[model samples]
Target: MHAISVRRVRRSLPRAALALVLAALGAALGPGAAPAAAAGHAEECSTEAGPYQKTVERHLKLTVDGVQSAADCAAIRTLQTRHGMEPATGRAGPETWRIVQYERAVADPSALTGCPHGTRLIVCVDLHRQLLWVWDGDHVATGPVPIRTGKSGYATRTGEHRIYERVEKQWSELYEGPMPFSQFFDGGQALHASYRNIWEEPGSHGCVNLRYDDAKRLWQGLRLNDPVYVWGTRGP
Candidate 1:
Protein backbone atom coordinates (compact mmCIF):
# COMPACT_ATOMS: atom_id res chain seq x y z
CA MET A 1 0.00 0.00 0.00
CA HIS A 2 2.81 2.38 -0.74
CA ALA A 3 1.69 5.77 -2.06
CA ILE A 4 3.67 5.17 -5.22
CA SER A 5 0.83 4.46 -7.63
CA VAL A 6 0.55 3.46 -11.27
CA ARG A 7 -0.16 7.09 -12.10
CA ARG A 8 3.17 8.10 -10.73
CA VAL A 9 4.51 5.09 -12.57
CA ARG A 10 7.27 5.82 -15.04
CA ARG A 11 7.41 4.67 -18.64
CA SER A 12 9.98 2.07 -17.69
CA LEU A 13 9.35 -1.45 -18.94
CA PRO A 14 8.98 -2.79 -15.42
CA ARG A 15 6.39 -0.14 -14.58
CA ALA A 16 4.76 -0.54 -17.97
CA ALA A 17 4.45 -4.28 -17.54
CA LEU A 18 3.00 -3.79 -14.12
CA ALA A 19 0.55 -1.27 -15.50
CA LEU A 20 -0.57 -3.66 -18.18
CA VAL A 21 -1.17 -6.22 -15.50
CA LEU A 22 -2.77 -3.64 -13.27
CA ALA A 23 -4.97 -2.34 -16.09
CA ALA A 24 -6.45 -5.79 -16.40
CA LEU A 25 -6.65 -5.94 -12.65
CA GLY A 26 -7.90 -2.39 -12.25
CA ALA A 27 -10.47 -3.13 -14.91
CA ALA A 28 -11.60 -6.23 -13.13
CA LEU A 29 -11.94 -3.98 -10.13
CA GLY A 30 -13.80 -1.49 -12.34
CA PRO A 31 -17.31 -2.27 -11.17
CA GLY A 32 -15.89 -1.88 -7.69
CA ALA A 33 -12.95 0.49 -8.22
CA ALA A 34 -15.07 2.66 -10.47
CA PRO A 35 -15.82 6.21 -9.33
CA ALA A 36 -19.49 5.54 -8.63
CA ALA A 37 -18.51 3.02 -6.00
CA ALA A 38 -16.45 5.66 -4.22
CA ALA A 39 -18.18 5.22 -0.88
CA GLY A 40 -18.88 1.50 -0.75
CA HIS A 41 -22.66 1.98 -0.22
CA ALA A 42 -23.76 4.82 -2.47
CA GLU A 43 -21.21 7.60 -2.13
CA GLU A 44 -23.15 10.61 -3.42
CA CYS A 45 -26.03 9.56 -1.16
CA SER A 46 -23.76 9.73 1.84
CA THR A 47 -23.96 12.95 3.86
CA GLU A 48 -20.64 12.24 5.44
CA ALA A 49 -19.12 12.00 2.05
CA GLY A 50 -18.23 14.78 4.39
CA PRO A 51 -14.86 14.88 2.69
CA TYR A 52 -12.45 12.28 4.13
CA GLN A 53 -15.07 11.13 6.58
CA LYS A 54 -16.06 9.01 3.61
CA THR A 55 -14.66 5.61 2.64
CA VAL A 56 -15.70 2.75 0.38
CA GLU A 57 -14.07 -0.04 2.25
CA ARG A 58 -10.36 -0.83 2.91
CA HIS A 59 -7.07 -2.18 1.48
CA LEU A 60 -5.73 -2.54 -2.01
CA LYS A 61 -5.62 -5.62 -4.23
CA LEU A 62 -2.94 -6.84 -6.59
CA THR A 63 -3.51 -9.76 -8.93
CA VAL A 64 0.11 -10.78 -8.75
CA ASP A 65 0.61 -10.23 -5.05
CA GLY A 66 3.87 -12.06 -4.59
CA VAL A 67 5.39 -11.62 -8.03
CA GLN A 68 8.55 -10.17 -6.52
CA SER A 69 9.02 -6.78 -8.08
CA ALA A 70 12.08 -4.66 -7.37
CA ALA A 71 9.42 -2.22 -6.21
CA ASP A 72 8.49 -1.53 -2.63
CA CYS A 73 5.89 -4.31 -2.61
CA ALA A 74 8.81 -6.71 -2.58
CA ALA A 75 8.32 -6.55 1.15
CA ILE A 76 4.83 -8.07 1.04
CA ARG A 77 4.01 -11.77 1.17
CA THR A 78 1.68 -13.91 -0.94
CA LEU A 79 -0.92 -15.00 1.61
CA GLN A 80 -3.60 -12.64 2.81
CA THR A 81 -2.68 -11.79 6.36
CA ARG A 82 -5.53 -12.73 8.72
CA HIS A 83 -7.73 -9.70 9.40
CA GLY A 84 -5.57 -7.57 7.16
CA MET A 85 -5.85 -7.88 3.37
CA GLU A 86 -4.05 -9.43 0.47
CA PRO A 87 -4.11 -8.18 -3.08
CA ALA A 88 -7.48 -9.53 -4.13
CA THR A 89 -7.64 -12.00 -6.99
CA GLY A 90 -9.51 -9.19 -8.80
CA ARG A 91 -12.94 -10.40 -7.68
CA ALA A 92 -13.17 -7.11 -5.79
CA GLY A 93 -14.04 -8.10 -2.26
CA PRO A 94 -15.74 -5.52 -0.09
CA GLU A 95 -12.88 -5.60 2.36
CA THR A 96 -9.92 -5.06 0.06
CA TRP A 97 -10.50 -3.66 -3.44
CA ARG A 98 -13.72 -2.04 -2.41
CA ILE A 99 -11.98 0.11 0.17
CA VAL A 100 -9.05 1.07 -1.99
CA GLN A 101 -11.27 2.14 -4.88
CA TYR A 102 -12.49 5.11 -2.96
CA GLU A 103 -8.98 5.93 -1.98
CA ARG A 104 -8.32 6.21 -5.70
CA ALA A 105 -11.07 8.78 -5.98
CA VAL A 106 -9.34 11.04 -3.50
CA ALA A 107 -5.76 9.95 -3.75
CA ASP A 108 -2.95 11.84 -5.42
CA PRO A 109 0.24 9.85 -5.62
CA SER A 110 2.34 13.00 -5.59
CA ALA A 111 0.49 14.79 -2.83
CA LEU A 112 0.78 12.01 -0.25
CA THR A 113 4.55 12.04 -0.06
CA GLY A 114 4.86 15.77 0.61
CA CYS A 115 6.45 15.56 4.01
CA PRO A 116 10.05 16.56 3.46
CA HIS A 117 12.99 14.79 5.02
CA GLY A 118 13.83 16.11 8.51
CA THR A 119 10.60 18.05 8.80
CA ARG A 120 8.77 16.87 11.92
CA LEU A 121 5.07 16.50 11.37
CA ILE A 122 3.36 16.06 14.72
CA VAL A 123 1.06 13.01 14.78
CA CYS A 124 -1.27 12.53 17.72
CA VAL A 125 -3.33 9.36 17.95
CA ASP A 126 -6.11 10.62 20.20
CA LEU A 127 -7.89 7.59 21.61
CA HIS A 128 -10.73 9.89 22.55
CA ARG A 129 -11.06 11.19 18.99
CA GLN A 130 -11.47 7.70 17.55
CA LEU A 131 -9.70 9.49 14.75
CA LEU A 132 -5.99 9.87 14.08
CA TRP A 133 -4.81 13.36 13.28
CA VAL A 134 -1.62 14.07 11.37
CA TRP A 135 -0.52 17.60 12.04
CA ASP A 136 1.74 19.12 9.38
CA GLY A 137 2.62 22.40 10.98
CA ASP A 138 -0.90 23.79 11.53
CA HIS A 139 -2.50 21.78 8.74
CA VAL A 140 -4.33 18.66 9.91
CA ALA A 141 -5.19 15.64 7.82
CA THR A 142 -7.57 13.32 9.62
CA GLY A 143 -9.06 9.91 9.04
CA PRO A 144 -11.65 7.79 10.81
CA VAL A 145 -11.13 4.10 11.35
CA PRO A 146 -11.39 1.46 14.05
CA ILE A 147 -8.57 1.04 16.56
CA ARG A 148 -7.82 -1.05 19.68
CA THR A 149 -5.31 0.20 22.23
CA GLY A 150 -5.36 -2.09 25.26
CA LYS A 151 -7.64 -4.15 27.44
CA SER A 152 -6.61 -4.55 31.09
CA GLY A 153 -3.21 -5.97 32.03
CA TYR A 154 -1.75 -4.22 28.97
CA ALA A 155 -2.41 -0.50 28.86
CA THR A 156 -1.17 1.84 26.13
CA ARG A 157 1.63 4.11 27.28
CA THR A 158 1.12 7.84 27.46
CA GLY A 159 3.62 10.73 27.24
CA GLU A 160 5.96 11.75 24.42
CA HIS A 161 8.02 9.32 22.39
CA ARG A 162 10.09 9.50 19.20
CA ILE A 163 9.77 6.79 16.56
CA TYR A 164 13.25 5.31 16.25
CA GLU A 165 12.58 2.77 13.52
CA ARG A 166 9.73 1.65 11.31
CA VAL A 167 8.92 -1.82 10.01
CA GLU A 168 7.02 -1.81 6.70
CA LYS A 169 5.97 -5.46 6.88
CA GLN A 170 6.25 -7.78 9.86
CA TRP A 171 6.04 -11.57 10.11
CA SER A 172 5.83 -12.37 13.84
CA GLU A 173 2.19 -11.66 14.77
CA LEU A 174 1.58 -14.99 12.96
CA TYR A 175 -2.08 -14.67 11.97
CA GLU A 176 -2.20 -11.57 9.74
CA GLY A 177 1.51 -11.27 9.96
CA PRO A 178 2.96 -8.82 12.51
CA MET A 179 1.17 -5.94 10.83
CA PRO A 180 2.62 -4.34 7.70
CA PHE A 181 4.08 -1.39 9.59
CA SER A 182 5.33 -0.85 13.12
CA GLN A 183 6.70 2.52 14.24
CA PHE A 184 8.65 0.74 16.94
CA PHE A 185 9.10 2.07 20.39
CA ASP A 186 10.20 0.11 23.49
CA GLY A 187 10.08 -3.63 22.70
CA GLY A 188 6.56 -4.31 21.31
CA GLN A 189 4.84 -1.07 22.18
CA ALA A 190 4.25 0.17 18.64
CA LEU A 191 1.60 2.01 16.71
CA HIS A 192 0.32 -0.82 14.54
CA ALA A 193 -2.81 -2.46 13.20
CA SER A 194 -4.65 -5.48 14.65
CA TYR A 195 -7.68 -7.74 14.16
CA ARG A 196 -9.25 -8.48 17.54
CA ASN A 197 -11.02 -5.23 18.19
CA ILE A 198 -13.34 -7.05 20.59
CA TRP A 199 -16.41 -5.79 18.75
CA GLU A 200 -14.50 -3.15 16.74
CA GLU A 201 -13.59 -1.27 19.90
CA PRO A 202 -10.44 -0.46 21.83
CA GLY A 203 -8.80 -3.76 22.68
CA SER A 204 -5.16 -4.66 22.14
CA HIS A 205 -1.97 -6.01 23.71
CA GLY A 206 -0.80 -2.57 24.87
CA CYS A 207 -0.13 -1.62 21.26
CA VAL A 208 -2.05 1.09 19.50
CA ASN A 209 -3.76 -0.71 16.61
CA LEU A 210 -4.60 1.71 13.86
CA ARG A 211 -6.77 0.76 10.89
CA TYR A 212 -4.81 -0.67 7.96
CA ASP A 213 -5.32 2.33 5.69
CA ASP A 214 -4.32 4.64 8.50
CA ALA A 215 -1.20 2.60 9.06
CA LYS A 216 -0.33 2.47 5.38
CA ARG A 217 -0.85 6.15 4.76
CA LEU A 218 0.96 7.11 7.92
CA TRP A 219 3.75 4.76 7.02
CA GLN A 220 4.33 6.48 3.69
CA GLY A 221 3.79 10.02 4.92
CA LEU A 222 6.04 9.67 7.91
CA ARG A 223 9.80 9.56 7.53
CA LEU A 224 12.28 7.41 9.36
CA ASN A 225 12.60 8.38 13.04
CA ASP A 226 9.57 10.65 13.06
CA PRO A 227 7.92 11.99 16.20
CA VAL A 228 4.66 10.44 17.47
CA TYR A 229 3.06 11.88 20.57
CA VAL A 230 0.35 9.68 22.08
CA TRP A 231 -1.87 11.04 24.89
CA GLY A 232 -4.54 9.05 26.67
CA THR A 233 -8.05 10.32 27.17
CA ARG A 234 -8.34 8.11 30.22
CA GLY A 235 -6.41 9.54 33.14
CA PRO A 236 -4.34 7.51 35.60
Candidate 2:
Protein backbone atom coordinates (compact mmCIF):
# COMPACT_ATOMS: atom_id res chain seq x y z
CA MET A 1 0.00 0.00 0.00
CA HIS A 2 1.26 3.43 -0.88
CA ALA A 3 1.75 5.99 1.90
CA ILE A 4 -0.41 9.10 1.56
CA SER A 5 0.79 12.32 3.09
CA VAL A 6 -0.55 15.87 3.19
CA ARG A 7 -0.12 19.32 4.70
CA ARG A 8 -3.57 19.90 6.16
CA VAL A 9 -5.28 23.28 6.05
CA ARG A 10 -3.33 25.55 8.34
CA ARG A 11 -6.42 26.38 10.46
CA SER A 12 -7.45 24.25 13.45
CA LEU A 13 -10.75 23.42 15.08
CA PRO A 14 -12.50 25.93 17.28
CA ARG A 15 -11.16 26.53 20.76
CA ALA A 16 -13.27 27.68 23.74
CA ALA A 17 -13.54 31.18 22.30
CA LEU A 18 -16.18 30.09 19.74
CA ALA A 19 -16.69 26.33 19.70
CA LEU A 20 -19.18 24.52 17.48
CA VAL A 21 -20.30 20.88 17.16
CA LEU A 22 -18.81 19.14 14.10
CA ALA A 23 -20.04 15.61 14.89
CA ALA A 24 -21.06 13.59 17.94
CA LEU A 25 -23.97 11.56 19.34
CA GLY A 26 -27.32 11.65 17.60
CA ALA A 27 -28.75 11.89 21.03
CA ALA A 28 -32.51 11.80 21.99
CA LEU A 29 -33.55 10.80 18.46
CA GLY A 30 -36.07 8.00 18.83
CA PRO A 31 -34.81 5.15 16.64
CA GLY A 32 -32.24 5.65 13.88
CA ALA A 33 -30.17 8.67 12.98
CA ALA A 34 -30.61 10.32 9.61
CA PRO A 35 -28.43 8.60 7.06
CA ALA A 36 -25.76 10.53 5.24
CA ALA A 37 -27.30 11.71 1.98
CA ALA A 38 -25.55 12.35 -1.34
CA ALA A 39 -23.63 15.62 -1.44
CA GLY A 40 -23.42 16.51 -5.15
CA HIS A 41 -27.07 15.65 -5.82
CA ALA A 42 -28.28 17.47 -2.73
CA GLU A 43 -28.24 21.14 -1.73
CA GLU A 44 -25.35 23.61 -1.84
CA CYS A 45 -24.83 27.36 -1.82
CA SER A 46 -26.25 29.16 -4.86
CA THR A 47 -28.84 31.53 -6.29
CA GLU A 48 -30.23 28.70 -8.43
CA ALA A 49 -31.28 25.31 -6.98
CA GLY A 50 -30.23 21.79 -6.03
CA PRO A 51 -26.74 21.62 -4.45
CA TYR A 52 -26.72 25.37 -4.67
CA GLN A 53 -29.74 25.64 -2.40
CA LYS A 54 -27.68 26.22 0.74
CA THR A 55 -25.59 28.83 -1.00
CA VAL A 56 -28.75 30.54 -2.18
CA GLU A 57 -30.12 30.58 1.32
CA ARG A 58 -26.86 32.00 2.66
CA HIS A 59 -26.84 34.66 0.01
CA LEU A 60 -30.37 35.67 0.85
CA LYS A 61 -29.67 35.84 4.57
CA LEU A 62 -26.45 37.85 4.29
CA THR A 63 -26.56 39.82 1.05
CA VAL A 64 -30.25 40.58 0.94
CA ASP A 65 -30.87 42.46 4.14
CA GLY A 66 -33.66 44.74 5.45
CA VAL A 67 -37.31 43.98 6.23
CA GLN A 68 -38.49 40.45 6.79
CA SER A 69 -40.14 39.71 3.49
CA ALA A 70 -42.04 36.46 3.15
CA ALA A 71 -39.38 35.13 0.79
CA ASP A 72 -36.52 36.27 3.00
CA CYS A 73 -38.05 34.82 6.10
CA ALA A 74 -38.86 31.63 4.27
CA ALA A 75 -35.25 31.38 3.11
CA ILE A 76 -34.08 31.86 6.67
CA ARG A 77 -36.51 29.22 7.88
CA THR A 78 -35.23 26.85 5.23
CA LEU A 79 -31.67 27.32 6.41
CA GLN A 80 -32.56 26.88 10.09
CA THR A 81 -34.88 23.96 9.48
CA ARG A 82 -32.44 21.96 7.37
CA HIS A 83 -29.60 22.23 9.91
CA GLY A 84 -31.80 21.15 12.88
CA MET A 85 -31.25 24.68 14.08
CA GLU A 86 -33.88 26.74 15.85
CA PRO A 87 -35.94 29.06 13.69
CA ALA A 88 -34.71 32.63 13.77
CA THR A 89 -37.15 33.65 16.48
CA GLY A 90 -39.73 33.50 13.68
CA ARG A 91 -38.58 37.10 13.13
CA ALA A 92 -35.11 36.63 11.62
CA GLY A 93 -33.23 38.67 14.21
CA PRO A 94 -29.72 38.20 15.59
CA GLU A 95 -29.95 34.44 15.28
CA THR A 96 -30.11 34.80 11.52
CA TRP A 97 -26.86 36.74 11.43
CA ARG A 98 -25.27 34.17 13.66
CA ILE A 99 -26.02 31.42 11.20
CA VAL A 100 -24.50 33.51 8.46
CA GLN A 101 -21.26 33.85 10.40
CA TYR A 102 -20.89 30.11 10.87
CA GLU A 103 -21.79 29.53 7.22
CA ARG A 104 -18.88 31.72 6.22
CA ALA A 105 -16.37 29.51 8.04
CA VAL A 106 -15.86 27.13 5.11
CA ALA A 107 -12.60 27.65 3.20
CA ASP A 108 -10.94 26.14 0.16
CA PRO A 109 -9.38 22.74 0.80
CA SER A 110 -5.61 22.36 1.14
CA ALA A 111 -5.09 18.90 -0.40
CA LEU A 112 -6.50 15.33 -0.56
CA THR A 113 -5.97 11.86 -2.09
CA GLY A 114 -6.72 8.18 -1.48
CA CYS A 115 -4.35 5.25 -0.91
CA PRO A 116 -4.82 1.66 -1.97
CA HIS A 117 -7.03 -0.56 0.20
CA GLY A 118 -4.30 -2.78 1.69
CA THR A 119 -2.15 0.05 3.01
CA ARG A 120 -4.43 1.02 5.91
CA LEU A 121 -2.13 3.90 6.64
CA ILE A 122 -2.71 7.45 7.95
CA VAL A 123 -5.63 9.78 7.08
CA CYS A 124 -6.22 13.50 7.73
CA VAL A 125 -9.42 15.56 8.08
CA ASP A 126 -9.66 19.32 8.41
CA LEU A 127 -12.55 20.91 10.31
CA HIS A 128 -12.25 24.27 8.64
CA ARG A 129 -13.60 23.65 5.12
CA GLN A 130 -15.69 20.65 6.10
CA LEU A 131 -13.77 18.62 3.53
CA LEU A 132 -12.53 15.03 3.97
CA TRP A 133 -9.24 14.40 2.19
CA VAL A 134 -7.64 10.97 1.92
CA TRP A 135 -4.03 10.92 0.78
CA ASP A 136 -1.63 8.41 -0.72
CA GLY A 137 1.71 10.10 -1.05
CA ASP A 138 1.08 13.49 -2.70
CA HIS A 139 -2.18 12.41 -4.36
CA VAL A 140 -5.56 12.39 -2.53
CA ALA A 141 -9.28 12.45 -3.06
CA THR A 142 -11.34 15.09 -1.29
CA GLY A 143 -15.05 14.76 -0.74
CA PRO A 144 -17.21 17.71 0.16
CA VAL A 145 -18.44 16.86 3.67
CA PRO A 146 -21.31 18.42 5.56
CA ILE A 147 -21.63 18.80 9.35
CA ARG A 148 -23.93 20.28 12.03
CA THR A 149 -21.67 22.62 13.95
CA GLY A 150 -22.77 24.65 16.96
CA LYS A 151 -24.63 27.78 16.06
CA SER A 152 -23.36 31.37 16.11
CA GLY A 153 -22.52 31.62 19.80
CA TYR A 154 -21.02 28.12 20.18
CA ALA A 155 -18.20 26.64 18.08
CA THR A 156 -16.50 23.24 17.89
CA ARG A 157 -13.32 22.64 19.88
CA THR A 158 -10.09 22.53 17.87
CA GLY A 159 -6.50 21.24 18.31
CA GLU A 160 -3.80 19.00 16.80
CA HIS A 161 -3.62 15.23 17.27
CA ARG A 162 -3.22 11.87 15.54
CA ILE A 163 -5.94 9.33 14.81
CA TYR A 164 -5.36 6.20 16.85
CA GLU A 165 -8.80 4.57 16.78
CA ARG A 166 -12.31 4.63 15.28
CA VAL A 167 -15.79 3.34 16.19
CA GLU A 168 -18.64 2.52 13.86
CA LYS A 169 -22.41 2.89 14.27
CA GLN A 170 -21.93 4.76 17.53
CA TRP A 171 -25.12 6.18 19.05
CA SER A 172 -25.20 9.29 21.16
CA GLU A 173 -27.63 11.26 23.27
CA LEU A 174 -25.68 14.37 22.28
CA TYR A 175 -25.58 13.80 18.51
CA GLU A 176 -28.50 14.35 16.18
CA GLY A 177 -28.04 10.95 14.54
CA PRO A 178 -25.86 7.82 14.30
CA MET A 179 -22.20 8.77 13.88
CA PRO A 180 -18.82 7.07 13.60
CA PHE A 181 -16.82 8.08 16.68
CA SER A 182 -13.12 8.82 16.11
CA GLN A 183 -10.45 8.71 18.82
CA PHE A 184 -8.08 11.62 18.88
CA PHE A 185 -6.18 12.96 21.91
CA ASP A 186 -8.85 14.10 24.41
CA GLY A 187 -11.22 11.20 23.71
CA GLY A 188 -13.72 14.02 23.49
CA GLN A 189 -13.60 14.85 19.75
CA ALA A 190 -14.39 12.48 16.87
CA LEU A 191 -14.05 12.28 13.08
CA HIS A 192 -17.49 11.25 11.90
CA ALA A 193 -19.47 12.79 9.03
CA SER A 194 -22.65 14.86 9.29
CA TYR A 195 -25.46 16.18 7.03
CA ARG A 196 -26.86 19.63 7.69
CA ASN A 197 -30.32 19.99 6.21
CA ILE A 198 -30.49 19.19 2.46
CA TRP A 199 -27.31 21.12 1.84
CA GLU A 200 -23.93 20.59 3.51
CA GLU A 201 -23.09 23.06 6.26
CA PRO A 202 -19.95 23.61 8.37
CA GLY A 203 -21.72 22.73 11.60
CA SER A 204 -20.87 20.19 14.28
CA HIS A 205 -20.76 19.71 18.03
CA GLY A 206 -17.06 19.73 18.89
CA CYS A 207 -15.59 17.03 16.68
CA VAL A 208 -13.80 16.99 13.37
CA ASN A 209 -16.52 15.44 11.24
CA LEU A 210 -16.62 13.93 7.74
CA ARG A 211 -19.23 12.82 5.23
CA TYR A 212 -20.42 9.27 5.83
CA ASP A 213 -19.15 8.10 2.44
CA ASP A 214 -15.86 9.93 2.86
CA ALA A 215 -15.43 8.43 6.31
CA LYS A 216 -16.32 5.01 4.98
CA ARG A 217 -13.71 5.35 2.27
CA LEU A 218 -11.12 6.49 4.79
CA TRP A 219 -12.22 4.00 7.44
CA GLN A 220 -11.38 1.19 5.10
CA GLY A 221 -8.09 2.80 4.08
CA LEU A 222 -6.74 4.25 7.34
CA ARG A 223 -4.43 2.48 9.79
CA LEU A 224 -3.91 3.31 13.45
CA ASN A 225 -0.54 4.90 12.74
CA ASP A 226 -2.01 7.44 10.27
CA PRO A 227 -1.75 11.16 10.98
CA VAL A 228 -4.65 13.46 11.96
CA TYR A 229 -4.37 17.27 12.02
CA VAL A 230 -7.01 19.63 13.52
CA TRP A 231 -7.28 23.22 14.70
CA GLY A 232 -9.71 26.17 15.05
CA THR A 233 -12.29 27.45 12.55
CA ARG A 234 -10.79 28.80 9.31
CA GLY A 235 -9.97 32.46 9.54
CA PRO A 236 -11.09 35.32 7.24
Clashes of each: 5, 48
Q: Model 1's lDDT to the true fold? A: 0.45
> Could you tell me every candidate's TM-score relative to the true structure?
0.44, 0.43
Candidate 1 on 1-236: residue-level lDDT in tens?
22110011112343335556656665777655743322223111111111211121123233333232322122122212333443322222223222343244235332323223234476665444333456666455544343456556666676666776677765443222456577765456676655333123225556667766778877878776666666655211
Q: Which tens-of-lDDT digit does each residue in 114-177 have in candidate 2?
A: 2232343334444443434455554444433443333344455554456655666654444435
TM-score top scorer: 1
lDDT of each: 0.45, 0.43
Worst 10 residues of 1 by lDDT: 1-10
C-alpha lDDT of residue 234 in model 1: 29
